[model samples]
Target chain A: GQQVMQIPQYQHVQEGEDFTTYCNSSTTLSNIQWYKQRPGGHPVFLIQLVKSGEVKKQKRLTFQFGEAKKNSSLHITATQTTDVGTYFCKGGSEKLVFGKGTKLTVNP
Target chain B: GAGVSQSPSNKVTEKGKDVELRCDPISGHTALYWYRQSLGQGLEFLIYFQGNSAPDKSGLPSDRFSAERTGGSVSTLTIQRTQQEDSAVYLCASSRWTGEKAFFGQGTRLTVV
Candidate 1:
């Protein structure tokens, strides 16, 4: 069995501040997918990192995969109130495993 | 359907009762998964179905929980003799393939009292 560990279970930041959440796995992963779940909403796909040491960016959000493919990170630059939600990382090849997730709250 | 759809968005049941949750995945998706999420908690893997293969039930907490996918499109998760601890949101997700990004349904919030 594989486990995905996520850090900073919860975070609260002032609007315009930056935030980062990290994900680590007990085993190497073929790919990692990121998801965002807004309050009262279901989880939505955010991005997917396949190549080792890959970095992808979407607007103010940046995602990076470790060179070993056992770790990943999501960073939000100048976060806004709309950024309040839980971010989860699913890692694996055949059977993807989801991390507990990091819940973020942005204060306006 | 435009997206994954779950029935009976919210359900309240008495303890010891049996409950069933339904999930209608997007057409053409080959992978379906069921997960449980307690309040302020992470997603707990429950079961997975891939095509016509036997489902992976390792994540099931007990014999009380079981799920089945029929015709490779719709799924049903049943809990027998439910307990108060079963209260949580049951989420269903589907992906086009084994390793692709998943699309999740709104989820069925179950409360066993």
Candidate 2:
């Protein structure tokens, strides 16, 4: 079994500001996936990183996989109110194990 | 694309009763998963299903909890002799195979009185 810990547990950012949440795993990860769960909504897949040192971008969001493949980060640039949600990272066994999640609040 | 869909979005049952929650995974998905989320909590892994292979039931909390997948498509999670501690949101997800990305359902909110 693998475990992931994400930070910061909660974050507040002004509109147009940037935010970053880091995801770390106790054991080496085969792959990592990021998800966002909006208030009153289900968790939606954001991105997946498989190779070590891989980096992917989705518009304003930049995701990076560490060289050791044991850590990942999701950085949102020029955040908007719509970015308000809890961000989670899953890194574990063939199946995914999710972290506690980082709740992001944007003040517009 | 049809995402994972769950039935009985909300359920209220008396303690000691049994309840079944259903999940319909996307067509062609070979991997399905069950998770729980308490109020303001993160997702708690419950079980995993992959093709014809044996399911991973290590996350099951107790003998009162059980789940089964039929024809590699739909899944049902049954909780017998439910207690107040069993109240939580049960979420289902499905993926292609191996370590592929997962798509989640809205989840069933269960409340035991």
Candidate 3:
């Protein structure tokens, strides 16, 4: 079975601080997708990275896929209170295998 | 449907009871997935359906859990002899295919007493 592991299971930071969560997969992934879930809400799609050593940015967030396609990272610059949520990464070929997720708490 | 729809946004059942959770994926979508999230926990993959091929049930935690997709559009997850630990939010998602961005439903929160 394929597995995706995320680091820093929980994180707390002051507003404007930067935060990063790392994800590693037990097997090489054809693609990786990022999702965010707000408190008391369902997960929502954020971004997807496929090519080797690929980097994509969405405003304050930057996502990077490893050259080997075995790992990925999500970096949030100058985090805001709205960024407080759990971030998940899914990786695999046939069925997406989700990582344990990184919970980010931003305090004002 | 416009998005993934799950039935009975919330449910309460007693231990040893059987419960069924339903999910309707977006029209024309080819991939559907089921995930469970306990309080303050991450998404736990339960099963997956892709087109007409055999479903992937490797993520199911126990034999007590089973799911079926009929007409490749709607899915139902059944948990028999439920336990207190079965209390969690069951989420369903659909995508164009494997590895694609997925859209998730609001999820059904199950409480086992």
Candidate 4:
């Protein structure tokens, strides 16, 4: 069985501040997928990192996969009120285990 | 369907009653997964069905929980003798295959009172 652990279970930041969440896995993953769940909404796929040490960015958000392929991170620059939600990382080859997720709150 | 579809957007049941939630996955998708999320909590894996292979039921919390996929299209999750702890939003997702991006349904919010 594989386990994915996310750090900083909850975070509250002022508007325009940056936030980052880390995801670590007990075993190496073939690929990792990031998802975002807004309040009262279902999880939506954000991006997927397949190559080791890959980095991808979307707007003010940046995603990076560790060179070892056992960890990943998501960083948001200059967060806005609309950025309030939970970010989850799914990692694994067979089951695609999901981390508990990091809940973010942006204060206006 | 364009995306995964779950039935009964919300449900309320007595503590001792049985309830079933349905999921219709995207057409031609081979992988379907069930996850439960308590209010303000994280997603908890429940079950997974891939193609015609045997389902992975290792995530089921207890004997009261069970799920089945029919003809590799639709799935039903049944909770027998539901308890207060069984209350949560049950989410269903589908992907073209394993290790692919998953598309999740809105989920069925279950309330046990």
Sort order, TM-score high to low:
4, 1, 2, 3
Model 4 over residues A43-84: C-alpha lDDT tens digits? 999999999999999999999999999999999999999999
Name the TM-score of candidate 2.
0.96
TM-score (chain A only) for the predictions, listed in order = 0.96, 0.96, 0.96, 0.96
Better lDDT candidate (2, 4):
4
Residue-level lDDT tens digits of model 3 in B1-113: 78999998999999999999999999999999999999999888899999998999998999999999999999999999999999999999999987788999999999999
Q: Which candidate, 3 or 4, has the higher DockQ?
A: 4
lDDT of 3 by residue, A14-50 (tens): 9999999999986798888899999999999999898
Models, CA RMSD each: 0.9, 1.2, 1.2, 0.9
Residue range B67-111, candidate 4, lDDT tens digits:
999999999999999999999999999999988899999999999
Better of 1 and 3 by TM-score: 1
TM-score of each: 0.97, 0.96, 0.96, 0.98
Per-residue lDDT tens digits of candidate 1, residues A25-99? 878988899999998888999999999999999999999999999999999999999999999998886665689
Note the Cα lDDT for every prediction shown.
0.94, 0.93, 0.94, 0.94
A21-102 in candidate 2: lDDT tens per residue?
A: 9999867888889999999898999988989999999999999999999999999999999999999999954776789999
Collision pairs in model 3: none
Cα misplacement distance, residue B26 of candidate 3 (Å): 0.4
Error of 4 at B89 (Å): 0.7
